[model samples]
Target: MDRVLLTKKGAEALQAELKNLKSVERPKVIEAIAEARSHGDLSENAEYDAAKEQQGFVEGRIKELESHLSIAEVIDPSKLNVQGKVVFGTRVTLYDIDAAKEVSYQIVGDLEADIDQGQISLSSPIGRALIGKSEGDEFTFEAPSGEKTYEVVSVSYDV
Candidate 1:
């Protein structure tokens, strides 16, 4: 599998979720299954069926999180030597030329992309265009709506 890129914060969040699932959720599901089994009639028991379904889901998620963590290449923005260019884990301020609006975005890994939270995946169109660019540089790209131009106002590695 290809190495998965993850910011330090994103990796920490995933680790926390994995810990919760393993320690708290797994034990609760096991207890629920045991309790349901005590009720008898495993074939027709609705409680048993529900517990089994929950177990399957929890186990699947655990495996998925573990696989992701195993392949994760965590990047710490503060430790990166990107100079002034936009790169993964860099927060950038941009000015839209057509709309005359200013927006801020953090270039992050695909799994951590959340536009509402001002984070854009490195593979995204705007993020791809911004990579290797420095402040005061203007670039144009094709957006879904139309062609859009943006000027890089600032770049920082700080969160």
Candidate 2:
């Protein structure tokens, strides 16, 4: 049970999901199971089987969320005192030296990392390279494609 990092927003999102599962989804699955049971002929009840399966899935997810939330280290970028250094939750814009284009990514916890949404996992190669970088700093890392170089153009923590 290693502790996992979470952004404030990411923790909130997980909490919201847990709440929904408990308050709404759990009740719905229970009702559906009960209704399916009432249909009789348990051996041939497809609805009952499906409802039970859904219940199992919902219950498993609830447990997972609870476990993750229990050990989560929620970090709010706004409350940080990092000055201008790039740390967790800092949104950094980089100038791709070879590509000659500006790109930006928000360093987020692993569970909430979505590259499609411009969020990169803190353990990711780019994230590791960008960590502790101040504005106007240049660094290079071995990208999966090849060695890539980037210059830190800006670092921000937007509330």
Candidate 3:
């Protein structure tokens, strides 16, 4: 399987979630399952059914987290020699031509992307266009509404 790329902060967040699942959520579900089972007649017991369903969800998440952590390639953007070029983990400030507004985004792995938080996946349209660009570079990408043009105002890996 191909390794999943993650920034230091992303990896830590995932690790924290995994720890919570294994140490807290997993055990809590197990206890619920046990308590439900004690009521007997699982086929007709609502508590038992709900607990079992929750257990499935918790277990699935745990497996997914384990799989990701096993092959995660954690990169610290602050330590990279970006040399003014935009790349994964770089925080890029852009000037939208049509909107005439400035926006900031951090190129990150798919799993860590949160557009509301100014993080975007490297494979995303705008992210792909910005990759390898430097300060003052301009690029265009197809957006859902239409084509959009942007100029790279600045690129920083200070994070």
lDDT of each: 0.92, 0.92, 0.91
Give the poorly placed runs of model 3, Cα more than 4 Å off. Answer: none
Count of clashes, each model: 0, 0, 0
Candidate 1 wrong stretches, greater than 4 Å: none
Output the number of the TM-score-best candidate: 3
Candidate 2's TM-score reads: 0.92
Q: For residues 1-159, what per-residue lDDT tens digits would candidate 1 score against the true structure? A: 877899999999989999999999999999999999999889999999998999999999999999999999998777878788898899999999999999999999988899999999998889899999999999998877988999999999987
What is the alpha-carbon lDDT of model 1 when measured against the actual structure? Answer: 0.92
* Worst 10 contiguous positions by lDDT, candidate 2: 76-85
Clash pairs, candidate 3, are none
Please provide, for model 3 over 43-65, each residue's C-alpha lDDT reduced to its tens digit, 9 standing for 90 to 100: 89999889889989998998998
Candidates 1 and 2 compared by TM-score, better number: 2
Worst 10-residue stretch by lDDT in candidate 1?
A: 75-84
lDDT of 2 by residue, 17-104 (tens): 9999999999999999999999999899999999999999999999999999999998887788887788998889999999999998
Sort every candidate by lDDT, greatest first.
1, 2, 3
Candidate 1 local lDDT, residue 77: 75
Error of 3 at 101 (Å): 0.6
Report the Cα lDDT for residue 21, model 1: 95
Residue 121 Cα positional deviation in candidate 3, in Å, after optimal superposition: 0.2
